[model samples]
Target: MSDVAIVAAGATRFDERIPRRAEELVAEALLEAFDGVKGLSLNEIDTLVTSYFIDARQVAEEWIIQDYIGHIPRAAFRVENGGGSGASAFYTAYSLIKGGLSDVVLVAGWEKMSLYRTLMANELIARGLDVDFDFDVGAIYTACYAMMAVRRMHVYGEREEDFARIAVKNRNNALKNPKGQWKRRITVEDVLESRLIAYPLKVLDCSLISDGAAVLILSSVERAKEITDDPVIVEGIGIGTDTMRLGDRAEITNFPACRVAARRAYRMAGIDDPVRDLDCAEIYDSFDTVELQTYEDLGFVKKGKGVEFIEETEIGGRLPVNMSGGLEGMGHPIGASPIAEIAEIFWQLRGESCNQVDGAERGLVHSHGGAGTAVVVSVLGR
Candidate 1:
């Protein structure tokens, strides 16, 4: 048995359009991943795990990237669990090293979503839903989450202003991130005034459609020290899944799968209380409201207390979250987004984050997939 650690991280800017193809974007990220790595070469990575959605853009995309990177004959595969694909791929790579099946692995994820117009791109994303019910009824991804938001209001009396506040916080954090997408500082009033995409989810409430890629190289603890003196250990990883259709769910106010996943990861990481144990977190925020709901789901606060905890998530507060600007501000590029989350935590633990939380030693990442159908929670430590 072996302990796994992230030896390096890399990413491309999240933007409306990059003009370059997916393979080129992937190459650019891979090159950046090796920038500061010492005494290690590309050939040292034994296996590759890739993740991405939007099959319409490129089918079996990993093969093209593998060939382009000269790893065509090596061990490699692709992972897709909606938006959680990147974290799931990282989980797989971690398992390979922990199980002694591989010494070093590369987890790469990307999305070339800006190729189509926003409407078409969103329509493509809606295909991830239950085609028999939600998709057939024309439920866009935003609507899927909006229904949850409306239900949370009905059950917990949460206000639309609560959701807007998250948007303001995340977009503002993007100001310091050169690779983040939406760097504009906004007000809660601005989010409320934006055109409504659903009943309560406005245009600004939704994550942007962007294209980007990210890479993380994972190695056994011994191998990690060879590459970097300071390695961020993979402390814990947990995943959970639920039924695809929302109507079939027993409760819509909060995602039970997320709680289950969080519990598993916490138990493994010896995190009795997340707020007390972790320094920072990069939660999956495909939509601004999702970020708030995730607080209770991850046990950061009790149910309905997410609104109160918003202020506490600020830079100087208890457990600052989404210091990388999250999906809302960084732009959710499907496969690449979750990898970006871990990359941010990797930086935070290494004291390299643009929005550094001083003295950060341990961090957590929660990756939510397809309207909360699945969740992946991982704990990382320096």
Candidate 2:
């Protein structure tokens, strides 16, 4: 298998409106990336992989992009894995290159969610869950996170303030990021006072429903080095799936799929200590408590001890998680989110993050598809 590396990455300005449809947003991102490639063109891209969810108006597939965006089509397809679809799409592209089926692959993740009513979009998102068992029992995504947060508090003595602090810190980080959706800083009081969507989960605790798209150009390492000087190598990739129905899982405190996927990535990367080796991280933070739980599941801390990592001031506080402002402030455009996570890490490693991590050389990114049912982990190094 050949090494896969990201040579160029681009995204449309993450906003509620980009004055364009989903295909146009995708073309913008791809064109931005294509401009940076030294010897690559839309015609050179042999494989095209994209992710899209809730685009009810038209078919959201790679061929649709090829014809509408006027790209020279070679081979293409769409990947659907709920919210984590972006990362899963990257994995698919990597597999294509690894198997020697394609020399250059363009991966794009997009969603134009603001086009629909909030309630209608909510209903569409709710469909990602098991319809008969989970959705039928009023198990909306936020509601599942609320139940997990409640259990986490009961078992680990976590405070609602801890979740609020996560929101406060990520939002503060977003202020430095021009591309982030929620750039204004907010206090813990602001988060606490926000309307409660679920029992302990407030509107502030949840990720924003925004429209955005991100694109990454991945090629074999040889082809990548030919295109760009600073290529982020895909050192390791891992994916895992758990029980789709939240009630079927044994515990809600931590995601087993995340642990399994992270373990696989660490093993492949030969990483014994993620906290010491990894410079920064971007994890799915659809909810504040999800970030906290991720610290434990990803081996930043012991099981049920993730809350302490957030409270205590330590040198390596669980891998500097979510320098991107995460999904909460970074804007979660469903399918576009996971690719955006990788894009932020790419900036950090290159010392180009407007809100850059100091001297970051290696980073990890994790994305969850639906609730905690599907997950993908990837480690990238300079």
Candidate 3:
């Protein structure tokens, strides 16, 4: 297979209110991405892969977006994997380039969630769970993650404060990110004292529900060099899924799908020690506990010792994680989350991150969907 590289990346500022339609958000991101890649034109793009979840306005939304972005007559499609939709769409673009099917591919993800009420949005998100086993039992998305946190605390002696620390770290990291939604520096005490959304998970611990979009321009390795001097190569890609029902999984604390996906990505990237080899990571931390658990699930730390990895992931530590503030501090637009994660890594590799990791070479992006049911892991390098 041919190598794939990301030539340009862009994102709109994440916020609770963005007076733009979904297609407009994507178009805006695409415009910024185009500006980054000098001489690249929309007509040169061979394929357009869009990610969006439950847009009530239209079916086959990618087609609409393609026309709105003035990329008509190009091949286009949509990919949805719950919250992992962005990474899934990105992986599709990577495959298109790697398989020699397309030269230049545009991947965009967006969610105009501010159009719905909070409860309505929750209900829409809850639809992703197993209807018979989870939704029917009155399980919301947060409750599923909360159950995993409860089990981790019980089995591994993880404390609620440990999760709170993750919140504090990400929120502090957000202060440096211009595009992040929550820029206020927070403390563990702040997180612990916040209202409880679910047992063991406070309001501060949950990711922000916001409106945003992210875009990435990918091409064949040769095409990438022609497009730009600094190209973030898609060194490796892996995706997997686990049991849909939360109770069906044998292990609640660890996501088997994430482990499987990470192993595949690491093997493909020739990474022996993720903690040592990866310069930084942008993980899908929709919940603080999820970030802590991802450290172990993605092999950044040993199982049951994820809480200990927190200090090591700090700004000056060996491997800084979520320098973009993750989904928690950045914003969670479901389908756009992983795309933003990839964009953050792309910038980090190019020495353009707002919270730059000095001498960064390789970065890992891990995105989770449907409460750990689906996972996509990618390793990008300069």
Order of all candidates by lDDT, from best down to worst?
1, 3, 2
Off by over 4 Å in 3: none
Q: How high a TM-score does candidate 1 get?
A: 0.98
lDDT of 1 by residue, 157-224 (tens): 98989999999999899888999999678999999999988989998888888899999999999998
Model 3 over residues 1-382: C-alpha lDDT tens digits? 7789999999998999899888888888888887888668888999999899876657887888888988888799999999999999999999888888999999999998898899999988999998867788788989988988999989999998999988998988998889999978778899999998889988999999899999999999888877998999988899989989877888888899999999899999999999888999998998989889989989887899998889988989989999999888889887788999999999999999999999999999999899899999999998
Off by over 4 Å in 1: none
Q: Which residue window of length 10 is worst by lDDT in model 2?
A: 311-320
For model 1, what is the C-alpha lDDT against the true structure? 0.91
Worst 10 residues of 1 by lDDT: 67-76
Query: Which is the leading candidate under lDDT?
Result: 1
lDDT of 2: 0.85
Per-model clash counts, in order, read 0, 1, 0
